[model samples]
Target: MGPSVMKKGLLLIALVVGGGCALFLYAAATRGLSAREAPSAAEAYATRTFRRWAVPANARLLRNPVPPNPETLRHGMEHWADHCATCHANDGSGKTTIGTNLYPKAPDMREKETQSLTDGELYYIIRNGVRMTGMPAWGNPEDGENDHETWTLVLFIRHLPQLGEEEKHLMSTLNPKTPSEIEEERQEEEFLSGKDLSKHKSTNGRKQ
Candidate 1:
Protein backbone atom coordinates (compact mmCIF):
# COMPACT_ATOMS: atom_id res chain seq x y z
CA MET A 1 0.00 0.00 0.00
CA GLY A 2 1.20 3.55 -0.67
CA PRO A 3 2.57 5.48 2.36
CA SER A 4 -0.11 8.19 1.80
CA VAL A 5 -2.89 5.55 1.91
CA MET A 6 -1.40 4.00 5.11
CA LYS A 7 -1.29 7.40 6.88
CA LYS A 8 -4.89 8.12 5.87
CA GLY A 9 -6.04 4.73 7.24
CA LEU A 10 -4.31 5.38 10.61
CA LEU A 11 -5.92 8.83 10.88
CA LEU A 12 -9.35 7.40 10.16
CA ILE A 13 -8.94 4.75 12.90
CA ALA A 14 -7.89 7.40 15.42
CA LEU A 15 -10.95 9.53 14.62
CA VAL A 16 -13.31 6.61 15.17
CA VAL A 17 -11.69 5.71 18.50
CA GLY A 18 -11.88 9.29 19.73
CA GLY A 19 -15.49 9.60 18.76
CA GLY A 20 -16.37 6.41 20.61
CA CYS A 21 -14.61 7.62 23.78
CA ALA A 22 -16.41 10.96 23.65
CA LEU A 23 -19.78 9.23 23.26
CA PHE A 24 -19.22 7.06 26.33
CA LEU A 25 -18.34 10.03 28.54
CA TYR A 26 -21.24 12.07 27.24
CA ALA A 27 -23.64 9.27 28.06
CA ALA A 28 -22.35 9.02 31.59
CA ALA A 29 -22.66 12.76 32.17
CA THR A 30 -26.14 12.96 30.76
CA ARG A 31 -27.20 9.95 32.76
CA GLY A 32 -26.05 11.56 35.97
CA LEU A 33 -27.70 14.84 35.06
CA SER A 34 -31.04 13.17 34.45
CA ALA A 35 -30.75 11.11 37.61
CA ARG A 36 -30.61 14.28 39.75
CA GLU A 37 -34.32 14.63 39.01
CA ALA A 38 -35.28 10.95 39.60
CA PRO A 39 -32.43 9.19 41.42
CA SER A 40 -30.19 6.53 39.87
CA ALA A 41 -27.31 4.40 41.10
CA ALA A 42 -25.01 7.37 40.71
CA GLU A 43 -27.17 9.56 42.97
CA ALA A 44 -27.20 6.86 45.61
CA TYR A 45 -23.44 6.71 45.47
CA ALA A 46 -23.20 10.47 45.91
CA THR A 47 -25.43 10.41 49.01
CA ARG A 48 -23.50 7.51 50.49
CA THR A 49 -20.17 9.17 49.91
CA PHE A 50 -21.33 12.40 51.55
CA ARG A 51 -22.91 10.70 54.54
CA ARG A 52 -19.88 8.48 55.04
CA TRP A 53 -17.19 11.11 54.85
CA ALA A 54 -18.04 14.66 53.86
CA VAL A 55 -20.38 15.39 56.79
CA PRO A 56 -17.93 14.54 59.55
CA ALA A 57 -15.35 17.02 58.38
CA ASN A 58 -17.76 19.86 57.93
CA ALA A 59 -19.05 19.61 61.49
CA ARG A 60 -15.63 19.24 63.11
CA LEU A 61 -14.08 22.15 61.26
CA LEU A 62 -16.93 24.42 60.33
CA ARG A 63 -19.34 23.92 63.23
CA ASN A 64 -17.84 25.22 66.42
CA PRO A 65 -19.18 25.86 69.98
CA VAL A 66 -21.75 23.12 69.63
CA PRO A 67 -24.71 23.65 71.93
CA PRO A 68 -26.16 20.75 73.91
CA ASN A 69 -29.24 22.59 75.12
CA PRO A 70 -32.63 20.98 74.48
CA GLU A 71 -33.77 24.30 73.10
CA THR A 72 -31.33 23.74 70.28
CA LEU A 73 -33.26 20.70 69.20
CA ARG A 74 -36.53 22.61 69.23
CA HIS A 75 -35.13 25.40 67.14
CA GLY A 76 -33.65 22.98 64.68
CA MET A 77 -36.99 21.25 64.15
CA GLU A 78 -38.73 24.50 63.36
CA HIS A 79 -36.04 25.46 60.90
CA TRP A 80 -36.18 22.04 59.27
CA ALA A 81 -39.92 22.23 58.70
CA ASP A 82 -39.69 25.59 57.00
CA HIS A 83 -36.57 25.04 54.91
CA CYS A 84 -35.94 21.33 54.55
CA ALA A 85 -39.38 19.71 54.82
CA THR A 86 -40.21 20.36 51.19
CA CYS A 87 -37.55 17.87 50.17
CA HIS A 88 -36.94 15.77 53.28
CA ALA A 89 -40.65 15.33 53.95
CA ASN A 90 -42.56 15.51 57.29
CA ASP A 91 -42.11 11.84 58.17
CA GLY A 92 -38.37 12.04 57.66
CA SER A 93 -39.08 9.99 54.54
CA GLY A 94 -37.15 12.45 52.35
CA LYS A 95 -39.84 12.60 49.70
CA THR A 96 -39.41 16.07 48.25
CA THR A 97 -41.54 17.35 45.40
CA ILE A 98 -38.38 18.08 43.45
CA GLY A 99 -37.11 14.62 44.25
CA THR A 100 -39.71 12.98 41.99
CA ASN A 101 -38.18 14.78 39.06
CA LEU A 102 -34.62 13.73 39.80
CA TYR A 103 -33.08 10.73 38.03
CA PRO A 104 -30.61 9.92 40.80
CA LYS A 105 -33.35 10.50 43.41
CA ALA A 106 -33.08 11.84 46.94
CA PRO A 107 -32.81 9.73 50.12
CA ASP A 108 -35.50 8.72 52.56
CA MET A 109 -34.42 9.75 56.07
CA ARG A 110 -36.87 7.38 57.77
CA GLU A 111 -34.76 4.52 56.43
CA LYS A 112 -32.14 2.94 58.68
CA GLU A 113 -29.09 4.27 56.85
CA THR A 114 -30.11 7.88 57.37
CA GLN A 115 -31.60 7.45 60.84
CA SER A 116 -28.39 5.85 62.04
CA LEU A 117 -26.29 8.90 61.18
CA THR A 118 -24.82 10.72 64.19
CA ASP A 119 -25.92 14.17 65.24
CA GLY A 120 -22.52 15.70 64.62
CA GLU A 121 -22.29 14.27 61.13
CA LEU A 122 -25.77 15.40 60.24
CA TYR A 123 -24.80 18.90 61.39
CA TYR A 124 -21.85 19.02 59.02
CA ILE A 125 -23.95 17.94 56.06
CA ILE A 126 -26.48 20.67 56.81
CA ARG A 127 -23.77 23.28 57.15
CA ASN A 128 -21.75 22.31 54.09
CA GLY A 129 -24.26 20.85 51.69
CA VAL A 130 -23.19 17.77 49.70
CA ARG A 131 -21.77 18.21 46.25
CA MET A 132 -23.98 17.00 43.36
CA THR A 133 -26.64 16.01 45.86
CA GLY A 134 -29.80 18.02 46.48
CA MET A 135 -28.70 18.81 50.06
CA PRO A 136 -27.51 22.39 50.52
CA ALA A 137 -25.15 23.96 53.03
CA TRP A 138 -27.17 26.31 55.21
CA GLY A 139 -24.00 27.49 56.90
CA ASN A 140 -23.52 31.13 57.81
CA PRO A 141 -20.30 32.34 56.29
CA GLU A 142 -19.58 34.93 58.98
CA ASP A 143 -20.50 32.87 62.03
CA GLY A 144 -20.05 29.38 60.58
CA GLU A 145 -16.67 29.01 62.19
CA ASN A 146 -18.37 29.05 65.61
CA ASP A 147 -21.88 27.99 64.65
CA HIS A 148 -23.83 25.52 66.76
CA GLU A 149 -27.30 25.74 65.23
CA THR A 150 -26.28 23.07 62.77
CA TRP A 151 -25.79 20.64 65.62
CA THR A 152 -29.26 21.53 66.87
CA LEU A 153 -30.67 20.31 63.59
CA VAL A 154 -28.73 17.07 63.87
CA LEU A 155 -30.20 16.39 67.27
CA PHE A 156 -33.72 16.77 65.89
CA ILE A 157 -33.11 14.64 62.81
CA ARG A 158 -31.55 11.86 64.87
CA HIS A 159 -34.88 11.36 66.62
CA LEU A 160 -36.73 10.62 63.38
CA PRO A 161 -36.99 6.91 64.14
CA GLN A 162 -38.77 7.51 67.43
CA LEU A 163 -41.45 9.87 66.13
CA GLY A 164 -45.01 8.55 65.73
CA GLU A 165 -47.25 9.36 62.76
CA GLU A 166 -49.02 12.10 64.71
CA GLU A 167 -45.77 13.67 65.74
CA LYS A 168 -44.62 13.61 62.14
CA HIS A 169 -47.63 15.61 61.00
CA LEU A 170 -47.17 18.36 63.55
CA MET A 171 -43.42 18.49 63.19
CA SER A 172 -43.62 18.80 59.41
CA THR A 173 -46.41 21.34 59.25
CA LEU A 174 -45.65 23.50 62.34
CA ASN A 175 -48.17 21.88 64.70
CA PRO A 176 -46.48 19.12 66.77
CA LYS A 177 -48.19 18.39 70.14
CA THR A 178 -46.19 15.65 71.82
CA PRO A 179 -45.01 16.96 75.16
CA SER A 180 -41.43 16.81 74.08
CA GLU A 181 -42.22 18.30 70.69
CA ILE A 182 -44.33 20.95 72.34
CA GLU A 183 -41.61 21.76 74.78
CA GLU A 184 -39.22 21.94 71.86
CA GLU A 185 -41.47 24.43 70.15
CA ARG A 186 -41.75 26.60 73.21
CA GLN A 187 -38.00 26.63 73.63
CA GLU A 188 -37.55 27.26 69.94
CA GLU A 189 -39.70 30.37 70.20
CA GLU A 190 -37.74 31.64 73.15
CA PHE A 191 -34.26 30.93 71.78
CA LEU A 192 -34.91 31.84 68.18
CA SER A 193 -36.67 35.05 69.09
CA GLY A 194 -33.61 37.06 68.05
CA LYS A 195 -31.63 34.38 66.20
CA ASP A 196 -31.59 33.15 62.64
CA LEU A 197 -32.01 29.57 61.34
CA SER A 198 -29.75 29.58 58.30
CA LYS A 199 -26.64 28.63 60.33
CA HIS A 200 -25.06 25.32 61.73
CA LYS A 201 -20.86 18.56 64.64
CA SER A 202 -19.05 15.44 63.81
CA THR A 203 -20.52 11.96 64.10
CA ASN A 204 -18.63 8.98 62.77
CA GLY A 205 -18.87 5.20 63.23
CA ARG A 206 -21.87 2.95 63.82
CA LYS A 207 -22.86 2.84 67.49
CA GLN A 208 -24.25 -0.62 67.15
Candidate 2:
Protein backbone atom coordinates (compact mmCIF):
# COMPACT_ATOMS: atom_id res chain seq x y z
CA MET A 1 0.00 0.00 0.00
CA GLY A 2 1.16 3.55 -0.70
CA PRO A 3 2.09 5.95 2.16
CA SER A 4 -0.95 8.14 1.43
CA VAL A 5 -3.36 5.19 1.69
CA MET A 6 -1.69 3.92 4.89
CA LYS A 7 -1.82 7.40 6.43
CA LYS A 8 -5.49 7.77 5.54
CA GLY A 9 -6.33 4.39 7.13
CA LEU A 10 -4.44 5.32 10.32
CA LEU A 11 -6.25 8.67 10.49
CA LEU A 12 -9.63 6.99 10.21
CA ILE A 13 -8.75 4.54 13.00
CA ALA A 14 -7.56 7.40 15.18
CA LEU A 15 -10.75 9.36 14.55
CA VAL A 16 -12.93 6.37 15.49
CA VAL A 17 -11.03 5.71 18.72
CA GLY A 18 -11.07 9.38 19.68
CA GLY A 19 -14.79 9.60 19.03
CA GLY A 20 -15.43 6.55 21.19
CA CYS A 21 -13.33 8.03 24.00
CA ALA A 22 -15.22 11.33 23.79
CA LEU A 23 -18.53 9.55 24.08
CA PHE A 24 -17.30 7.55 27.07
CA LEU A 25 -16.10 10.70 28.80
CA TYR A 26 -19.42 12.42 28.15
CA ALA A 27 -21.34 9.49 29.64
CA ALA A 28 -19.09 9.40 32.68
CA ALA A 29 -19.55 13.09 33.29
CA THR A 30 -23.32 12.98 32.93
CA ARG A 31 -23.96 9.70 34.75
CA GLY A 32 -21.60 10.47 37.63
CA LEU A 33 -18.92 7.88 38.41
CA SER A 34 -20.81 5.70 40.89
CA ALA A 35 -20.02 2.11 41.65
CA ARG A 36 -23.51 1.51 43.05
CA GLU A 37 -24.98 1.33 39.57
CA ALA A 38 -24.42 -1.58 37.22
CA PRO A 39 -22.55 -0.96 33.98
CA SER A 40 -24.53 -0.40 30.80
CA ALA A 41 -24.47 -3.04 28.05
CA ALA A 42 -22.18 -0.85 25.97
CA GLU A 43 -19.80 -0.46 28.90
CA ALA A 44 -19.85 -4.21 29.56
CA TYR A 45 -19.03 -4.90 25.91
CA ALA A 46 -16.16 -2.45 25.95
CA THR A 47 -14.76 -3.95 29.13
CA ARG A 48 -14.90 -7.46 27.72
CA THR A 49 -13.31 -6.31 24.46
CA PHE A 50 -10.52 -4.56 26.35
CA ARG A 51 -9.88 -7.64 28.48
CA ARG A 52 -9.64 -9.79 25.36
CA TRP A 53 -7.19 -7.36 23.80
CA ALA A 54 -5.13 -7.13 26.98
CA VAL A 55 -4.37 -10.86 27.13
CA PRO A 56 -1.29 -11.77 25.10
CA ALA A 57 -1.83 -13.80 21.94
CA ASN A 58 0.51 -16.53 23.20
CA ALA A 59 -1.16 -16.57 26.60
CA ARG A 60 -4.47 -17.39 24.95
CA LEU A 61 -2.96 -20.56 23.52
CA LEU A 62 -1.12 -21.59 26.71
CA ARG A 63 -2.27 -24.83 28.34
CA ASN A 64 -2.54 -25.85 31.96
CA PRO A 65 0.44 -27.96 33.00
CA VAL A 66 -1.29 -29.33 36.09
CA PRO A 67 -3.18 -32.60 35.78
CA PRO A 68 -6.91 -32.51 36.40
CA ASN A 69 -7.92 -35.17 38.88
CA PRO A 70 -9.85 -35.66 42.12
CA GLU A 71 -6.83 -34.61 44.16
CA THR A 72 -6.30 -31.53 42.03
CA LEU A 73 -9.94 -30.57 42.37
CA ARG A 74 -9.79 -31.00 46.14
CA HIS A 75 -6.75 -28.77 46.43
CA GLY A 76 -8.31 -26.19 44.14
CA MET A 77 -11.49 -26.26 46.21
CA GLU A 78 -9.54 -25.64 49.41
CA HIS A 79 -7.59 -22.77 47.87
CA TRP A 80 -10.73 -21.24 46.44
CA ALA A 81 -12.59 -21.51 49.74
CA ASP A 82 -9.81 -19.89 51.72
CA HIS A 83 -9.13 -17.15 49.19
CA CYS A 84 -11.69 -16.73 46.45
CA ALA A 85 -14.84 -17.72 48.32
CA THR A 86 -15.05 -14.32 49.94
CA CYS A 87 -16.09 -12.82 46.63
CA HIS A 88 -16.77 -15.68 44.22
CA ALA A 89 -18.76 -17.79 46.75
CA ASN A 90 -18.53 -21.55 47.28
CA ASP A 91 -20.99 -22.19 44.41
CA GLY A 92 -19.27 -19.74 42.03
CA SER A 93 -22.50 -17.72 42.13
CA GLY A 94 -20.79 -14.47 43.16
CA LYS A 95 -23.72 -13.77 45.48
CA THR A 96 -21.74 -12.78 48.56
CA THR A 97 -22.20 -9.28 49.94
CA ILE A 98 -18.78 -8.13 48.75
CA GLY A 99 -19.25 -9.68 45.32
CA THR A 100 -22.63 -8.07 44.73
CA ASN A 101 -21.35 -4.62 45.70
CA LEU A 102 -18.37 -4.54 43.36
CA TYR A 103 -18.61 -2.16 40.43
CA PRO A 104 -19.34 -4.28 37.35
CA LYS A 105 -19.97 -6.84 40.14
CA ALA A 106 -18.40 -10.26 40.42
CA PRO A 107 -19.73 -12.53 37.68
CA ASP A 108 -21.65 -15.72 38.30
CA MET A 109 -18.93 -18.15 37.29
CA ARG A 110 -21.42 -20.97 36.75
CA GLU A 111 -22.99 -19.02 33.88
CA LYS A 112 -21.97 -19.23 30.23
CA GLU A 113 -20.25 -15.82 30.40
CA THR A 114 -17.53 -17.37 32.55
CA GLN A 115 -17.79 -21.04 31.59
CA SER A 116 -17.45 -20.21 27.89
CA LEU A 117 -13.93 -18.85 28.41
CA THR A 118 -11.03 -21.11 27.47
CA ASP A 119 -8.90 -22.68 30.19
CA GLY A 120 -5.97 -20.52 29.15
CA GLU A 121 -8.10 -17.40 29.45
CA LEU A 122 -9.20 -18.38 32.96
CA TYR A 123 -5.61 -19.14 33.99
CA TYR A 124 -4.35 -15.87 32.55
CA ILE A 125 -7.07 -13.93 34.38
CA ILE A 126 -6.26 -15.68 37.65
CA ARG A 127 -2.52 -15.09 37.35
CA ASN A 128 -2.52 -11.55 35.98
CA GLY A 129 -6.00 -10.21 36.93
CA VAL A 130 -8.03 -7.70 34.95
CA ARG A 131 -7.43 -4.02 35.58
CA MET A 132 -10.29 -1.72 36.70
CA THR A 133 -11.98 -4.69 38.33
CA GLY A 134 -12.10 -6.40 41.73
CA MET A 135 -9.95 -9.37 40.69
CA PRO A 136 -6.41 -9.36 42.04
CA ALA A 137 -3.30 -11.07 40.64
CA TRP A 138 -2.95 -14.16 42.78
CA GLY A 139 0.06 -15.78 41.15
CA ASN A 140 3.59 -14.53 41.60
CA PRO A 141 5.45 -13.45 38.46
CA GLU A 142 8.56 -15.14 39.87
CA ASP A 143 6.70 -18.48 39.80
CA GLY A 144 7.52 -18.49 36.09
CA GLU A 145 5.53 -20.93 33.95
CA ASN A 146 5.10 -23.53 36.71
CA ASP A 147 2.21 -21.92 38.58
CA HIS A 148 0.52 -25.19 39.47
CA GLU A 149 -1.98 -23.67 41.88
CA THR A 150 -3.37 -21.28 39.30
CA TRP A 151 -3.67 -24.07 36.75
CA THR A 152 -5.50 -26.16 39.32
CA LEU A 153 -7.87 -23.24 39.79
CA VAL A 154 -8.56 -23.27 36.06
CA LEU A 155 -9.72 -26.86 36.30
CA PHE A 156 -11.90 -26.04 39.31
CA ILE A 157 -13.48 -23.15 37.45
CA ARG A 158 -14.40 -25.53 34.63
CA HIS A 159 -15.93 -27.89 37.17
CA LEU A 160 -18.19 -25.14 38.55
CA PRO A 161 -20.99 -26.05 36.17
CA GLN A 162 -21.03 -29.57 37.57
CA LEU A 163 -20.60 -28.50 41.19
CA GLY A 164 -22.29 -30.79 43.66
CA GLU A 165 -23.97 -30.18 47.00
CA GLU A 166 -21.36 -32.29 48.77
CA GLU A 167 -18.57 -30.24 47.21
CA LYS A 168 -20.20 -26.99 48.32
CA HIS A 169 -20.66 -28.36 51.86
CA LEU A 170 -16.97 -29.28 51.97
CA MET A 171 -16.00 -25.85 50.70
CA SER A 172 -18.15 -24.18 53.37
CA THR A 173 -16.18 -26.09 55.98
CA LEU A 174 -12.96 -24.83 54.45
CA ASN A 175 -14.07 -21.20 54.13
CA PRO A 176 -12.43 -18.60 56.34
CA LYS A 177 -14.44 -17.49 59.34
CA THR A 178 -14.47 -14.02 60.85
CA PRO A 179 -13.52 -13.51 64.50
CA SER A 180 -17.14 -13.01 65.51
CA GLU A 181 -18.20 -16.14 63.63
CA ILE A 182 -15.43 -18.16 65.23
CA GLU A 183 -16.34 -16.87 68.67
CA GLU A 184 -19.98 -17.65 68.07
CA GLU A 185 -19.06 -21.19 67.06
CA ARG A 186 -16.93 -21.58 70.17
CA GLN A 187 -19.80 -20.43 72.37
CA GLU A 188 -22.19 -22.73 70.57
CA GLU A 189 -19.83 -25.62 71.05
CA GLU A 190 -19.55 -24.82 74.76
CA PHE A 191 -23.31 -24.59 75.05
CA LEU A 192 -23.75 -27.83 73.17
CA SER A 193 -21.36 -29.51 75.58
CA GLY A 194 -23.62 -28.46 78.51
CA LYS A 195 -21.14 -25.86 79.72
CA ASP A 196 -22.17 -22.88 81.90
CA LEU A 197 -24.22 -20.22 80.04
CA SER A 198 -24.62 -17.62 82.83
CA LYS A 199 -21.79 -15.51 81.40
CA HIS A 200 -23.68 -14.97 78.14
CA LYS A 201 -26.93 -13.95 79.82
CA SER A 202 -27.77 -10.34 80.71
CA THR A 203 -26.22 -9.45 84.11
CA ASN A 204 -28.49 -6.67 85.33
CA GLY A 205 -28.74 -8.34 88.76
CA ARG A 206 -32.51 -8.43 88.36
CA LYS A 207 -34.80 -11.50 88.45
CA GLN A 208 -36.44 -12.39 85.12
Candidate with the greatest TM-score versus the true structure:
2
User: Any runs in candidate 1 off by more than 4 Å, and if so which?
Assistant: 1-14, 17-33, 36-51, 55-70, 175-208
Candidate 2 residue 79 C-alpha distance from true site, Å: 0.8
lDDT of 1 by residue, 1-208 (tens): 9999999999999999999999989987776434444545785677677557645454544433456455776687777777777777765776666655544455777677776665556666676777765677796867654566666677667766666776666675673246877756755885779544333101323232
Over 31-87, each residue of candidate 2 has an lDDT whose tens digit, in order, gives 978887888999999999889888888888888888889999888989999999999
Name the runs in model 2 displaced over 4 angstroms: 1-30, 197-208
Top candidate (lDDT): 2
Q: What's the distance in Å from true for residue 30, model 1?
A: 12
> What C-alpha lDDT values do all the predictions have?
0.65, 0.88
The TM-scores, one per candidate, come to 0.60, 0.78
Instruction: For candidate 2, give the lDDT.
Output: 0.88
Model 2 lDDT, residue 5, Cα: 100
